[model samples]
Target: MVDIEKKIIEIIKHKPVILKKIYELLQAENKEDRRLIRKTAKKMLSDGIAYKDSKNKYHLVSSKQVVGTIEFTKSGNMAFLSDKNGDEIAITVENSLNAMHKDRVLIEKIGQWRDLPSGRVIRILNNEIERIVGQFQKKKMFGFVIPLNGKINYDFYISPENMNNAKEGEIVEVEILKHKSKNKNPEGKIIKILGKPGDPSIDLPIIITKHGLPNPGEFPKKVMEEALKIPEKISKKEFKGRKDFRDQLIFTIDGDTAKDFDDAVGLKKLNNGNYELGVHIADVSHYVNDNSDLNKEAYKRSTSIYLINTVIPMLPHELSDWICSLVQDEDRLTMSLIMEINKDGDVVKSNIYNGIINSKKRLTYSKANKILENNADENLMEEIGFLKETLESMKELMYIIRENRKRRGSILDIESGEVYFEFDENGYVKDILKRERGISEKIIEEFMIKANETVAEFFDIKGLPFIYRVHENPDGEMLIQLKNYLEILGIKFKIPETMHPKVLQEILEKTKDHPLNESIQKLLVRSMKRAIYSNNNIGHFGLASNSYTHFTSPIRRYPDLIVHKMLKKYIEGKNDLKKQDIEKYSKILPDISESCSKKERVADEAEWDLIDMKKIEYIRKHIGEKYEVFVTGVTKFGLFVEIPEKMINGLIHISELDDYFIYNERDNSLVGDKTKKTYRVGDKIKAVVAKADKLTLQVDFIPYENYIKINKKNTKNYFNKKNKNGNKKTFKKKGKNK
Candidate 1:
């Protein structure tokens, strides 16, 4: 068969051939030989080694043709596919050939488009869009569903019978009945009605349904049953070989609303004056046995999705929020990492073992920060007085560890830009606030980093099959782009061919006091690749660590659960690993890592979408309100502005200016052609909200001067500003000049 395949490939490589001609060329027309030849040719076509044209002629796949997954841009205007050599080729909407996002397709290189390699999808090997979440719109006779996912351009056609009694404006999940084609929209039946738009209850469901994640607080019956079978209280049998730490001064620090306490911390001063730091993570592996329904469900979810107030957990609430959560004053099983560190923050010795812990207290970051900064009130200080010494020592050690991380060239001080929401009595968002990471957050972060690194190093030295959280270095092209962007801000630095985190660290330090620090950091972050879980250990570029893995938060993250199980097996084997177990793990870990990475991305995107939706919803109530915003970005189409007070970003179109504007690429500015007005990063302007769309997650703003011009009769007595030309009729700002 191999010989026959080779002959067929060789024949087709020279020139495209019909089946009969190939048989004639090879002279293998016998019954058995014909069967084998035809089978081999079919296999080659399916495996992308060859492709059959419309004329039923076979041709070998060459550099001119590539087979890969189609990745669509957010707006669905363009797509990208990678060749065998991992080079990206752009595919415009017209050339997409109706291929959906993530669909495997074969594309032929047509030519160059916009200075990049371009292609047209010739054939789709796989159709990945089976279900879609969209808004149902009823027409005169029938209805269609408009997809909420920005990457899917076509509206799903729904006949009158397939409407499933769904309302006109309700969000619905559609099961694709027929795929889209050149002239026909995809046909689907409404399978589920999520809810109506603007209903606070439906916000999360929209994102959840769109991403195909498990609905919040819901799990499979079998998985839930299995979780219910696990004992809520620790049994004597479970305590075997586990060290006892119930009497230790251990505690958990998380957000005020956080219910799943996955890790607890403890500290003590060693005999030699070194600091002993203890990180106890919930032993979820003990309960979620391999090959069990609970384990399978955990793997399916991969990681918990935190969408503001709702949490779609990997494990059921019976496990994640109960038995496995390190609730205060409750005995629970855990895997503990004990490390002895010197004053310089170097871990001289470390130990990992099964253990039991009783969290003495549950503290929120706000209260913990107050204790750490000595700003706690009298009653609060007295209540935590017993933990005073340990808390102070923990704070001191956090800074030391942070400094050590800095010494090793870790990129730190990047703002998270996380936001929190305040809700009205009716569950509607009333205000959005920025979440500030304080000392207590840093303490937990540093400790988890050390613990994860220690466990990874231990397994790395033993050469065991393991999963690693790896962040590869930024691409050279993206770094060049970053350099160009930085130069526009008057910060010029040459990026090296082989860049290090420290180099970026130094650049961040240079911008520490710059007004555009957040924007700069966000740009640099975009220039870097997203961190992912991988079976291969390539080291983590962001953390500047030679070894790293997710060892904490097993209750929320599946990778951590897997790490716990792997660590247990290695420890039980006492460094004498078995060949069969290693072989089994080595085969499965790669797929598991890839699945987890993909799921993690989906969770992040869902969370971001929900947040952006809520932000738009909040802005909708104040449509005519004016805000002082900073120009965070400038382009030919518009200026990207952020309201610092609210931490919400919006766009002011170039046409919104009083005069036509030209984009100056060198200075990264938009200049008004007539007024000589300029808008650049860090420039502040007053703007009024022009529009906000929850569907697109976009906020549009126009200068206040334009708003005044449109409403001069109502505001003529209030505005007393003059333009640069000394015209009292013109205000400094304008609205909706477009």
Candidate 2:
């Protein structure tokens, strides 16, 4: 029988015949011999060493074929071939048994149908993931872990001995031991136990896992010790050959809670009736040299992560907050952009140099705004008398510059807002507010903008290699959609064939005082592409500049530090930057920019997640209570409503809309089929807190028609009456009284 099985296997291996033919060829007079051949063939087929083609022919898979990575979706697996232009092939779970998400696998194109590709995973080239987050479960004798991240759908069956003291209901980091195989679930071992489920601290790990970011581990002892050794004082030798601006009345302006002051500004009326505007940034690169421990740590962080009440700084507090920070009344080394601007705000002359600066005072935006509004304190009023005069002159120059910018088709009127959190002594949020644009913020912004533009232009004229912040124009399809949406609201928006910043700015200005201003501004921002760092100058669309780069805030931004280094090299006449090096930097800049951007997004997500959790807790106490909400976002799934009083937003799912209509994606609305009732984006409505789920951090809202409709009608009447007065003037709409 063994001899017969061996003979049959050999024949099958060498035969290029159909299964029917092979079966016929392997025919034996005795039933025992035939059964043996059949069993062997079945085993070989199951092993994937052989496959049946469309014609039912059995053959060995060719070794030299296509290879690529497999990306797993919620439904199944799709193999992305190595050819840059090749269409990805779909792989069924039966054939993708061993492959995991982002794992490199050898794919053999079995066939193609109507331009769609089909393939099987012949071999898994590489396994991309080593650790994953999951919930641990226990059986009678063994355990199983289910991944929280849906991308890793498979459960890992763990032996009881390998449970590593992790209890049921505990979230943990699991190390993959073996991928999915024929007779077992993917095996894994518990590496580290995260906290109990539903803990607020678990949000950090979840976000980190979702974004594939590194966990915050203890700093290396050597790195920490070296960072501790950084001196607190600026050395005299460090100031050699550098420009000195210590006598300049430079002052730092930031949020009241801000710790690290990276930038300062000084404005004065020059002898020639021009304005001397000095923008100085901390000289971080001077202390953090290349290949040093501090530099390595900064590069690893890439950017700071600011959560609700915590900031994970890129550099340690010793350096970021004290040593490098431009603290008030403290002398610090800095890289300065000194611009001599005429009354028209045109840059007449500019100089970039390393310098020493003393921040004469630390000003908060509130104080500055108060002073600008003529409500300054006695001491502040005295101290800022000359400064206010200088600022008034600078303001005039800025307006001229701004007018010139607008005339040059610049997009300078984009709406932006920051979330304000009022925290108690314990760093818990007492209140949350939306911080909008103010004159003080605008003044600082204008100065910083002028400084950045001047430095960028200088670099361009010098033909130096520096990282520029570039934003490309929006895609045609997005702009068309935006135009159509605006038209639906009776708003006239003309998007050019080649969408430019000026067109966007014009639309924003037109809608600045509209009821849907926030919604429209958000949509406009969404329509534009994200700005990124690059060596080549593509120009900035948001800033409406032909060339722009980060030349301010070197204390926090790595690109600004790099820009400073380049400026220094240029000033020293050492223009030895090779084209290839610049090209390399160009290529590398995008990846770094993407990484930093991802971190920023993660930080935002973490902060929002915590806030959402807190909001859920806050609303739980107010269940059955009503509040005025503005419809901020609309989707087929649900509407997002922002509670203006608390500055918290929650979703009103489609199922909870009380039989209102199907969603209209085109108009961003929901309309009833029978009544023709419509709920549109940016419409203010009163809603009662129906449900607050702490586990999900979800708040469900149900519309309070009786409370909202009355106020809405009154608002409409007031607007109509105001319009009847022949005044096409801007007016603020008040929400309904709760």
Candidate 3:
């Protein structure tokens, strides 16, 4: 077998283009012979001496040639290779189709169409995880496993003897026993059964597997023991060289369900008439020392995963929830940003320090909102009077600062939505709510922004190596598409070549009262580039600021924690690190940022998926009932409508539209070719629930005739004119009598 593998490697090295035919020939054999050949081929491929073509053809790529990680879709047939240059190349599932997601593979470019290079996976650089979470099933004498994640499209063939204790409909983890060939599914054996389908506990296993994230249960006891050793109470020695702000009336504002409080704010009127606002963030780095068990665990997880009903913290409960948490009345260590701002919200003086703080109050946004509206309880009124006054003063300062940001061309006011969950004691969602933006959220946001900007500016002045939160300008193509979409809606908004944040803000301001404000805002956000962490201080496009960095909430966000460390290092005049060290840090910072961002997105998707499942469950009883909906998306296959009252979305299939016959991509509408009836994105309509699939979390809808009638009557003249001038006029006469 070893000699055969060596022969295969030599053959590929000599004639790489013949890999496809060779593999095919080897596969078209008896079972025992094929197994032997496959083992040899697998070993040879793993050596990285050859490459595969997009067509599944094999060829030899040089040992020093380009290679990258390959991620497979569930189908096990196709894969995408992410190269060192950040370019992803698509590969057919056939030739080297056995490679899984995140498997490093060597590739040799085979051809090109125009400027697009095409390649194939020649050698498997590494194998992905052998274990996967799926559901077990039996069909007569045979058994199979269906993967929980859509990305893992291939079903595993499970032998009866290796079924373990898994029963039909039981969610279980499976270990791959054998690789797939041209005519067979990969063989697997059930290892552990999780729970029955639709069980809430099943969700965590599914989510963990789906995103390829490690299970929290895997945390070592050593790490847990180390985490427990960290002191919960503040000590004099720990507070050495730290400023004391325990006497200040600082407070934390978070959600009702929030356990870990990481940030606190305090405001005071300075003698010079300027406001001295302090943003204090929990200093997790102080206790979770570098290279320690707790630090290692936190670094591995990167960020906490906030699901609908649970928060999977990066640090264990000892640190994330109890010890380092900035709970009210508890003396906690914090990295503080003390800034002096004039009446116009212009920064006059700023300083960063390691400090001890005592939070005076812990407030929820809802309660704060009520109090700010002057509808406060007796005790609340007395306890929160100073904080309320400070909040009002902060609001005034924020408005001025916001205006200044706008004048400077910052891109603010993107329409963003937050999903709120009402959970049962069992950890299941009772209800899902779309949290609306309010003054309370804005107050916190404004302070965080001011703190971040101040820190960035301070680091810039010091000429230090620091991580900055930067957002580059949007891609030219995306901007053009945005402009085109706006033009289609008869909205004249020009996106400059070098666009500023103020331009976006202006557009939002102009369309604030418009019916399509939400739609336009969504488009604007989609067109912008994502913000990332980097050592270089490029300006943030979304904030419309020249320089920005994450300096707030160091306890939860790793980048902010890194920023604090760098700031402290610079403040102490430790200029020992070299240019090479800075460059090395800069290169890895982007990767870390990208990884953390991906994890955040995965968490978001999992949360959405769970909520969608709960939503389907909630609406199950309402099938066939009608609700008012707004068209949120339009595609060739269907129109997506969201129930405005509940924010639940369903698809109105193209076939379900009896009146509208033509799909128009230009205006994003479905039109009746004969009657010229139109249903466009952002247009309000009534839709009846047609079907709901619990397994897929898909909701189907059909138009409500009564609502359509009302819509038609409201825009009678517009529809009449459109009908008279449309191409539908030619088909009108032929279809009317039929």
Candidate 4:
């Protein structure tokens, strides 16, 4: 069979040959040989070793043709195809051949465009975007829904019959029926009406639908039944083989509004003066059996989606919020990672085990921080004064761990902002504040990092097939760009041949006192690769850890639950496993890793969409009001500015400026041609909210002086409706969500 397959490939290697020609070349006389050749050719085609053209001729897949998934920029005017090796080839909209974002397509290279390989889509292998969430607009006889997702440039036409009684201006979900032709829009039907756009309650739901996430409180009936069938109260028999930590002064420190306490921490000073840190994570894997409906649903979701105040949990609320949550004074089962740390903050010894713990307190970050800072209120101090010594010791140990991490080249100064909404009684946002991470948050973070690394290192050393959280090194090109930018900023830094996180850490340290410190840190972060899960272990770059995995939030993250299950198996078998089972895990874990990574990205996008909407909503209430903002981005068309206090970014169009501004690519600045004024990243200026549209999720800003002086002028038609050259308007039309 192998000989026949090799012969068939040789027959079609150099030229496009039909099946009959290959069959004849092989000299197959028997019916079995013919069937085998036919099967081999089909398998080769599917496996990308061979490609079949329109005329039913097969050629080597490497013959100027490739398979990849297409993605578009947010503006949708340009697209790129990313092949399996992460190499991207540019594809113009015209050459895209009507292929949408995320469509797997076969492309043939045409020629080089701007020195990069460009391609035209020859065939679309598959399009998985079956449903779209959009806003409906009814015309005389029919209606069309404009997609809210920025990647989709075209609209879905909804005929009168397919409208499903959807009203005008309603947000609806559309199921694509067919793609008519290259230039025509796809046809679809309205499947569900979300709500009006500006309604506060509808914003989150729209984002949820747009990202294909399950709505809040919506779970499959069988999954819910399974969740209910689990006993709410822990029975005595369930405590078998579990270590008891109920008498320890263990507690959880989360946000004030947090309900699901997945991990609790405790610290102790050992006889030799080393510290024992206990990180008890909720034992979600205990109740969620691998073959059960709950497990299926959990794996489908992979991780909980936290959209503003709404949480679409992977597990049913019965498990995520009730029995599995480590509430105060309540006994809960956990998978504990107890590590013994010396004064040098090294994990000298560690152990993982099933444990039962009754958390002594449920402390918020604010409360814990107050106690650490010795600023707690009298009543609060009186209530938990007994735990102060342990809490202070934990704080001291946290610094030790953090210093150790810093010594090992971890990049820790990157600032990620979280926009927290303060809602009124009617659920409208009254204000938005950027949540700051305090010392208490850092304590939990450091402990969780250590725990994850310990478990992952254990399994990694045992040479077991297990999932790992990996963050690869940044691309060399991006590091070069970053170095150039830093040089432009006058902060000279050398780029090593082999990049290391410590170099980035040193650059950040240099910018610690710079005016653009925060912006520079953000730019550095953007240059780094996103951390993801994989069955193969790659050292994490950002944390500077050799082995890492998510093992601290099982109730919220499915991978952590799986980690718990793997740890339990290791404990039971002492790393002994059947050869077949090892092969089974090795085969299946890669797919699981890919699925979880994809789902995690979806969850992040959904959360960001919701936050962007809320930011627009909050800005709308203060339109025409002036605020101090910093220019974070400079483009040919505009300057992207962010209000530091609110953590909201908006655009100040070039047309709004008094003089004609030319984009300086050398320094990424906008310089006035005549006035000699310049605007660049990190430049502070006062700007007024010119416009905020919820439907488009855009916020436009105008300079404070310009806003006051040209209050009645039409800024879009400014400069006498033309630029300096008088060819046309310089500012381009705003693409949806661009």
Q: What are the runs in model 1 whose C-alpha is more than 4 Å off?
A: 1-68, 82-89, 108-117, 165-168, 193-195, 475-489, 709-711, 714-738
Over 1-738, each residue of candidate 2 has an lDDT whose tens digit, in order, gives: 446546655676786566456557777657776677667666555333455555666665454345555776633334334322234576666667577776766677777634557677776656777877777888889899887655565789988878999988688888889887767778999888887764556656655554455555345676778778988898889889789999878888888899999899888887899888888999888888867887777666666666555666777778888989999888898988888888777899888888899998888887777777788888888866656765566567767778867866777776555566665564344566777766767777888878888888876876766678888888665676678678878988886667667787788788989877776776777788877677668898777788888878776677777777667666665534556655655555554555455455455656666666566655655655678888877788778988865767788777555555788767677887777877776678888666665434567776766324434655333222223212222223254322
Q: Residue 280, candidate 1: how far off, in angstroms?
A: 1.1
Q: Candidate 3: misplaced stretches above 4 Å? A: 1-66, 71-80, 91-96, 110-118, 214-218, 423-430, 461-463, 475-478, 574-590, 659-679, 705-738
Name every residue pair that clashes in candidate 2. none
- My TM-score estimates for the predictions, one after another, are 0.86, 0.74, 0.81, 0.86
Tens-place lDDT digits, model 1, residues 241-301: 9999988999999998898999999999988989999999999999989989999989999
Rank ordering of all candidates by TM-score, starting from the highest: 4, 1, 3, 2
Identify the leading candidate in terms of lDDT. 1
Per-residue CA lDDT of model 3 for 234-275, tens digit only, reads 777888889999999899989888988888998888888888
Candidate 2, which segments miss by more than 4 Å at Cα? 1-218, 379-387, 391-404, 409-415, 422-430, 574-617, 644-647, 663-668, 692-698, 705-738
* Local distance difference test scores for all models: 0.86, 0.70, 0.71, 0.84
TM-score of 3: 0.81
Angstrom error of the Cα, residue 17, model 4: value is 16
Give the clash count for each candidate.
5, 0, 17, 0
Model 4 stretches with alpha carbons more than 4 Å out: 1-68, 109-117, 165-167, 475-481, 575-578, 708-738
Residue-by-residue lDDT tens digits, candidate 4, 1-738: 568768877777777899988878888788998899998887676455676766888877676787767888777788887554446788998899979877777888898878578999988767768888888999999999998887888989899999999988888988889864676789999988887767787887678767778889899999989999999899999999999999988998899999899999999999999999999999988999989999999999999999877899988989988899998999999998899999999999988889999999988898888888889999989987777898889998999999999999998888778768988888778899878898899999989998999999888987888999999998765576577668878888788777788889999888899977877876687679999999989889999999999999989888898888888887787655456657777866876887799799889988888898888888877775789998888889999999988988899998888788999876778899999999877778999776776767778888878755554445534323432211222233342322
